[model samples]
Target: MVADGTKRSRIGMGFLVGAALVAQPTAARAFNPFGLFGEDKPAVTANAVAYDLQVQGLDGKSDVLTAVRDVSILYRLRQEPPQTGDELVRRAEADIPRIVDALWGSGHYAARVSIVVGGQVIALDRPASGPVRATVDSLRGRALVPVAVMIEPGPLYRFDRVAVLDQRSDLPFDPAELPPRVVTIAPGDPARTADVLQAAAALSDHFRDRSHPFVKVGRRSPVIDHTARTVDLTLLVDPGARAGIGGIGVSGTKQVDPAVVRSFIYAERGDPYSRRAMADIRRSVARIEAIGGVRVREGTALDANGQLPVEVEVTERPLRVIGGSVRYSTIDGPALKAYWAHRNLFGGAERLRIDGDLFYFTGPQNWPGGSNRRGFNTDDIGGRLSASFLKPALWGTRNDLLVDAFVQRELTELYTSNVVNGTAAIRHRFTDSFNVRAGIEGEIGRSTDVLGRFDYGLLGLPLAASYDTTDKPLDPTRGVRVTASVTPYLGFGDAPDAFVISRIQASTYYALDDAARTILAGRVAFGSILGGSIGAIPASRRFYAGGGGSVRGFEYKSLGPRTLGGIVTGGMSLFEASVEARVKLTDTIGIVPFFDMGQAYAGSVPDGSAPLRYAAGLGLRYYTAVGPIRFDVAVPLARRQGERPYAFYVSIGQAF
Candidate 1:
């Protein structure tokens, strides 16, 4: 019986230690480096009590108050009150050093903290007196214990002097020689612990960027002058031997060939070691669909070749993936899309995907010359089937080959067509943010429009370039994205013509605050068909704007030029611009108010003959792990005759 009881005590202690380690914040952890359990004490069972925790002397110091509250075990676990007054006393005792550290971290180096439990002052310098013990003992059967925390936040410490020195020589660098941004800590600036530590890290990075792979910020010695309320900080840096790239290795590759993984890394042997190179290597390896995660490890010391050795560790994701999405709009009806992909084919990180989509399930069935009333009809349904193949690192580490083919039938207000198209392209990534592609595409289709029925076969060469610096793909808060593309085509069969289509679009985002809770985003786009007349070009090849992705207030493809007989003919030129203010009301929810303007013209360019349509709307976003689920309600600011008063849309991700 004794042995069993001992074992149970040990187990309970182990659980408590684990929980404390996980629950405590960084400041608390630093104060108690060892596990929280000093010795195993038997669990005490007493009636839980309601308690009032009052923190004083921080009336105006909200920052310090918040920090203190965050690290207070009594405040954090208030819902589950301590079973005994002794346990409460222990918790208050444990919080003393943590609270002091929190105060010091916020530049209050001379701060003092005290605690009074149940009207008994717990002196920091001495153990509890007889009367204090008696007061605590009297709370054995009480239902309440009022605790007060008193803090004396002296003066805020400012930087007196800051210096960076060589670890071995103990020689300080001249202040004038160091870069302006390297030593962020300056005299007269608040000597907050975070700023001091950040300055040390910045100094270390400065040397590391200059080819010091093993640079270390060895020690930070701070001397506090209490009388002057200032701190003098000195950072010791050990910039190890300058090194170059040594042996590059890859590990954790299961199905992917190790050699193929190495090909994705752009860093070469004997190249000067750089932090940027390691980041680039990590990104390149992660770009592979099969690679779930990547870790670039650097050797602690230089290798036999006097260069830094790098090891690329990667975790493989599932080989096969299947997913789908659905979207709907008042004007375009509902659409369902599904796809299945093989991330790694033949162990080379090659990807192959097949997709199927059904759209316009219940939408307006307006033939070339018919009424626009919405209705459901089996014959009006449109669907598409497509397949795509990607071969990464085809010619070199920076290039990839892409091949795609699709067959689809469309039923729209302006035209009806069944088309098959195929494209082969080689995309070369110049950098993480920039890429360019040139491809050859061919399309064969037959369509019936307001003009008449026509069969056409077209061949085109398309060249495109994209630059994106957005922080996130689904929803971005900052940076810009620009894309330009031009495709020259030769039409054959029934509709013989030559045309060149050129388009350029740019979007930018600016975060209004550091947290990015509010963002201002804008976009502008322009497109023109230089050669072919509007009537000669295939309806599918022409530009049309409206609906969910374009001007949201209007119907799908309803913003372009119309025929005299009331048939809607697509445009040869297009222009679009939109602005949005995305504001997050909560972590998982956001609201966006947006304005959109654009027009499609019969002429080859936007000649100002046609007026631009305007729309304004408010959108609700439910943020998720993958992206935001979007719901928007929009109305045309300048509603034309016969146009709907408002439109609503539901989809995933941001509108852009």
Candidate 2:
């Protein structure tokens, strides 16, 4: 029998003694810094006394045995021996119903539990009398107590009948009409409480997603029959009137224009109400750099027009931000990058960002004791500085204006170039997953390669289109992404040429399990430079592969045609493919085993001027709220004469 808490408190000193014993730490327990009664208190103590806890009658039902142990206070605290036999007996008595509840949750409606302490049986019907006190007193001086929790988990109950009823009409839905996926559970299925609750939730979502904003899932009723070992369950659903979109309100605007925010929302007055549309509205609004957070709220009651009104609440991020990052790879050495951005430059959600990257302090071939070792020079350093501006709603809410300019100096094994370039483009979003951009670009540069130094001026028109359905930009668990681009250029000065460059790349992700613990991902890319001779094309414009972002194990730009002097000169065509398996070992940690193959070709197509290179690697990922931190190690399957044995890379986000 449980003691009355009110009576125990009135008997002040007696209650305090029991509370102290339960609160204070002993040799068998450690102090909980969170609080004596904090919800995070450890269920099991490390220093608890040794005790035998036998769970019987579970047969081979390991899952049920695990469930029982999870909820049993006697098992959890067995190591923390109570200060008195009375406390121990009280704990054992409290665990009986909890154990029964656990059994019921697993479809065992008829269950029995028995607990024994020392050599005494604890009767389920024992009263709060002198005999109970005598049992406690008899074990008071015992150094150790043997405890046993015996359970008779009865027959697992299965569903005999399942029904869904509309509360408003007080009519049951036809079982044949209800979708099996939505209802989840059916007759003859195990009547687990979890599955029953999941079905109720799914039914509510099915209606809510179909323009019913006020859908409600009423109480669930279950009828159990111990004799037949079966349960009859029914769920009530209340789907309110269907509604359309009404007035939209915007709030929490500090610096951004409210009209601009509203324009980004996909919903319009009188449009059909849809959960997907609301989600799109949230995503579009949140994409603005000025917005830190966004929330879409639907009114509880329809307006006079019988349509739902929505409120858009937004939180503004800081207007100015300065951030930087560092990355390293055994092949590329070390790199440092930094950026500064003005999110709301002119108050209409215009964005301006300036970025700088410095890389390759020491050339890859100059590493100490290498085959091609050389001393470092200032010319070995490479960097780029760029600035970009974006004006949203340039023509309409779906269009944006982008302008960019950059000055760069690139030093690699294949070439060295210094260039200045600029571009102006208009990007139009046809839908959330699709977009296209067309732009005019101008470049003036001087480059040195195996063909020798030359100065050139070039003007070009560039166009690109992309489609993406991945769940995340940094790390994706599903969906496919494809991008295609074409650029045509006219050259002047020392090298005069006319040429076009076209490329297409596609990648896809698939989750192998429902929980996304395992994933299969693949990528393929191809590019070609048409109409221009190898010597007439700029080294920067030529195709090249082999690096952390390409073949992984090989040096950057080291897998193309070579000059008579054996120096890599890049190529006119490129092809690459990669496949990887991502497996999670724990919630926050994962491992990826990947294979990559590709090569650059000297001709307009892969004419087999050089055989394709192949590499294999393993990666580690530390998942976080923003993205996963990645570390990868790779080795070439077929080692070339001059290549390193292996390479390692460290950075953030997935390799793709």
Clashing pairs in 1: none
TM-score of each: 0.79, 0.78
For model 1, residues 1-656, the per-residue Cα lDDT tens digits are 01121121221221101111111111111121122221222222256544566676665677777777778887777666666566777788788767877787788766767677777666345345566645665665554566677677677878888777888789976656456668767899987767867776887778777789878885554666656776676778888788999999999998987766876787789988888788878987787888999999999888888999999999999999999999885545789999999999978888999999998644444564233545545666788999999987774467889999999988676777889999999998776778999999999998878878878999999999999988788898889999999999998987657889999999999999878999999999999998867778888878898888888888878888887765568898999999999999999999999999988999999998789999999999999999989999999987978899999888888988
lDDT minimum window of 10 residues, candidate 2: 15-24
Alpha-carbon RMSD to native, per candidate? 9.3, 8.5
lDDT of 2 by residue, 1-656 (tens): 22232221122221011110011111222122222112222233333333445655665677787777788887677656666657777887787767766777788765666666665555456423456545555644443455666666667879888878888776786555446568868889987767877887788778777788888876554666656777777788888898988899999999998877876776789988877778878988898889999999989899999999999999999999999989885445689999999999999889999999998745556332122445556666778999999988763477889999999988765667889999999988777778899999999998887777779999989999999988888999999999999989888885557889999999999999988999999999999989867888888888989888899988777788888877777899999999999999999999999999999999998899899999999999999999999999999987978788988877789988
**Which candidate should be chosen as best, given TM-score against the real structure?**
1
- Cα lDDT, model 2, residue 465: 98
Off by over 4 Å in 2: 1-103, 112-155, 165-177, 186-189, 269-272, 304-306, 326-329, 364-376, 495-497, 585-593, 607-610, 616-622, 631-639, 644-646
lDDT against true structure, model 2: 0.77
